[model samples]
Target: MSVATLHYIHDPLCGWCYAAQPLVSAMQAQLGDRLALRLHGGGLFGEPRRVDAALAQHIVHSDERIAQLSGQPFGEAYKQGLLADEGTVLYSLPPIAAVLAAESLDAAKAYPMLAAIQNAHYQRGLRVVEPQVLTELAEEIGLDGTHFAQALARADGHTLFEHVQASRRLLDEAGGHGFPTLLLEVDGRRTLLPHHHYYGRPDAFVQMLAGQLPAVH
Candidate 1:
């Protein structure tokens, strides 16, 4: 059987990526070990930036649309707390590095780490850019404290920069249009899947992927 790889291009800070979590989970359950799920952090907020009142309001409006379409919850902590906090810095690399750190220690935990980071950000209004926060999230996801600390320390530096660069290159090669781009690769050919069509309908998403899997002979 030919290997089928699904490349997910996303950023932790992206509300849409969080909205796509259900679809990702459905794909995981449907494909199991039959397919490989690869996550790429495209670094939407690669630089350290602050969200002003106006920008925060804009984000809230966008988030409401996402919640309406995808059925993903946006906690009050996020809408009222994090967004309202003027001094809070937004950067994607730190959380992306946390994911890389988890992946380095255990591949299975990578997605879980990403999920946890999203939860902490959207649900709990935590400052994910802080190393301490990232470490706590890692431990919460069952990763060993000592090893994860070392891995995160290493990843927070040049490793994360290199990974983001490579991820962006992949996006450019795929002709992707921003975060949450899903590319299905069967054999050596890659086809970009129209994932937005099934935002809240994960079953439909899995069925579509199932129809394509037979070609991987």
Candidate 2:
């Protein structure tokens, strides 16, 4: 019996990463027990170095393109509510920290919480920068709110910083193009999978892996 590892490199605040969620979910379902699906946080955004009309316009345009390609929903609330609201820059540290905090408590909750956070931001236009909002989300997902809050309180500490660094290292090792990168590894050797497999037909993703690796029986 052979086992393959699929590493999904993503960031919670990445629009493209959110767009790839369905594809990743399908991959998880189709692969079943044939492979290990590992989630890695790729650092994509930072404190608002420069966010203005040009950046906002580019974001909307890119989001539209992603929607067209992936058939993923980018709600009007996200556009009109979050994007229209000013004083909100492209900050990612808090969301990533929340993911790390969840992972610390329960590894299984991390990726699911990532999906929930993405939905909360992309659909509901809820604030991801606020610890309070993230805590509420944690509670909604059955995570211990007090524990999540304590971990988030230590967001600026070494633990979260180490998670960020580890993600960056994995991303670089995979030679990822951007967020939502996928890599396959078997017997200690790694191979980068094309992003197109995740676009609209995730079934094709399953077929592609089946052709290259052991089939899930």
Top model number, TM-score: 1
Candidate 2 stretches with Cα past 4 Å from truth are: 49-51, 215-217
Residue pairs in candidate 2 whose N, alpha carbon or C atoms collide under 3 angstroms:
none
- lDDT, candidate 2, 37-70, per-residue tens: 7877766785643446777788889889888988
What C-alpha lDDT, on a 0 to 100 scale, does residue 72 get in candidate 2?
A: 84
Q: TM-score for candidate 2, please give it.
A: 0.90
Q: Model 1: how large is the Cα RMSD against the reference?
A: 1.5
Quote the lDDT for 63 in model 2. 89
Query: Candidate 2 at residue 128, lDDT?
Result: 80
Candidate 1 lDDT at 67 equals 92
Q: Weakest 10 consecutive residues, lDDT, candidate 2?
A: 42-51
Could you tell me every candidate's TM-score relative to the true structure?
A: 0.96, 0.90
Q: Candidate 1: what lDDT?
A: 0.90
